[model samples]
Target: MIMQVKNKYVYRSKISEAKFRQIVRLFALDLDATQISQIVGLSRVTINRYLMAIRERIAKFCESESPFQGDIEVEYEVDESYFGPKRVKGKRGRGAGNKTIVFGLIKRNGKVYTEIVPDCSKSTLQSIIRGKVDTNSVIYSDKWHGYDGLVDLGYGKHYRVDHGKDEFVNGKSHINGIEGFWGFSKIRMSKHRGINKKYFYLYLKECEFRYNFRDENLYLLILKIVRINPLFLS
Candidate 1:
């Protein structure tokens, strides 16, 4: 039995590893609570119970530090992706909307560090860079005016590909990896319409987790899941 904060109640179930796997698979496939309940022949209340357990479990997965330290390889890219809400019909430039800003740092080879940010201001983006990246690494990004000041933050190398002038590359200066990630993320979100903003970060964390560890064995993955949060099991 477990108590979930969002849904007021305690639920008891003899859920197994296989059942948990099905739950995740269905979730990744974008099935909602009603659909998942019907597919699993479980009550809506029971399905929500399992989903809460899964969320709490995945939150624990982030406790372990990612293996990458400092700059990744010889090149790295940083970018921001906005989601949740859009500018009203015609308005633009950070006007009031429900949008959430997310920051990402990706190695040329595809490793990434992602986070939910309150806004895309220079200070906010710099804080993330300071925490996750080494100052000695070369950073690549589009010619966003805010990022122009990163050199003052001690980044030894900075490169910009001016998208405004079609200068995407001069050699190794492009943000393609991170751009592709944002595209994939937006596409995934679009397929599901819109996600509840409160739960948006959780979904982003899951995507990064899956993208970074796509090659592990099924049993090993299950072990990782168990380790992610055994509190729910307890």
Candidate 2:
């Protein structure tokens, strides 16, 4: 029997509607493919396909609902974090071994946006900030040279805490919000052991979606996204 999820019909599925809904609900609860397979009585491969489909929908939702429009006027925290296996021996921050660089921006008491970047150089970071953030907004960050000229680039103010000097917060100038998100993302992703580099961005986008809708009902939200954006099925 075909199941109607929101506005679309689930066709060509061997499992019943209740079982498919169970799989999707488990996925929203952050279960891995293996655990979901065991719980849903499906093969691991089938569960993996369902998980990928969910991730694809999340990616599309994030892209279509991106909050970076150069109109954010609030206390914004910005930071960069590396994601990958720990380096045995090498420089840690910035030019670390082989890790993916993710730049993040978060408005205090608001949503967050993250993007995979080639590097955290001044030029690269500045370009993204200029496009995403609004002018005359106060920006906070750690003492990274990449964030150096934000005020000069038209921000209202730029505050930084020198982490190298063991300073984390100075009055209200800190990147704790965005940094906290980095920690949260890493902890969630750790459950999967490791994701492929090729599809790392999709998983990363999923993290962003989760964080953005942390306070809302995510299962219903996922249904809404799937219903509104049929392109996600492609």
Candidate 3:
């Protein structure tokens, strides 16, 4: 159930390299494990195992890659979203139960970075922003009080869109890019019905990878990452 390649062991559970690559290709195409199992003629359990392996590899690859840094002269959007089961009939936003908080930053026509945070408090969010974003970057976000002190935190400029007033954009300020990412991630995850909370961070990183490489050959890109980080399979 293992194969050694270039002196490194690559896990293979009775799945040939060709078939494994096929499964990965289907995965890149956004097929659910069940759908891929039907096409590849593999059992759903086997397919799901392969997916978990791939997702773990993706998580390692993303961790090896450095966080966003340097000055961002161009505009960038920052936002936070909650991910989890839908609320039955409770208050929305902040106090909703069964929700996981995620913070994200995306540059206009550039890459994106996301993380599962403990909370959306100003201190928590500000620390992350200071580390990942440049000190003088132009940032755009909704009127979330957590992001209120960003201007004083050394950003070149900070703009807010009052979503409470039904305003989503102003002359040159909006979080449409990051918000679009949230929608994209939610829709994609919906196909899986639901993901386990324990592995949600890995799935979240996969979403980040997908969005960051949206303009490139995702299949080849994934293969490249795996090839470079072959030890991730262990």
lDDT of candidates 1 onward, in order? 0.70, 0.82, 0.81
Please, what are the lDDT tens digits per residue for candidate 2 over residues 43-148?
9997887678778888978888758564555788899999987864956667487899999999888899998999999999999888888887888988889988
Decide which is better by TM-score, 1 or 2: 2
Model 3 scores a C-alpha lDDT of 0.81
lDDT of 3 at 24: 76
TM match of model 3 to true structure? 0.90
Candidate 1: Cα lDDT at 192: 55
Tens digit of per-residue lDDT, candidate 3, span 1-234 = 355443221343455567767887999998888999999999998788778878888888877776465545767799998999877485666737769999998888788888888998999888988888887678899988999888777785988999999999898888999999999999888877888999999899999888887788888877776666542333
Clashes of each: 0, 0, 0
Model 1 weakest lDDT span, ten residues long: 4-13
Question: What is the Cα-based TM-score of model 1?
Answer: 0.79
Model 2 pairs whose backbones collide: none
lDDT of 2 at 91: 68
| Model 1 Cα shift for residue 158 (angstroms) | 0.9
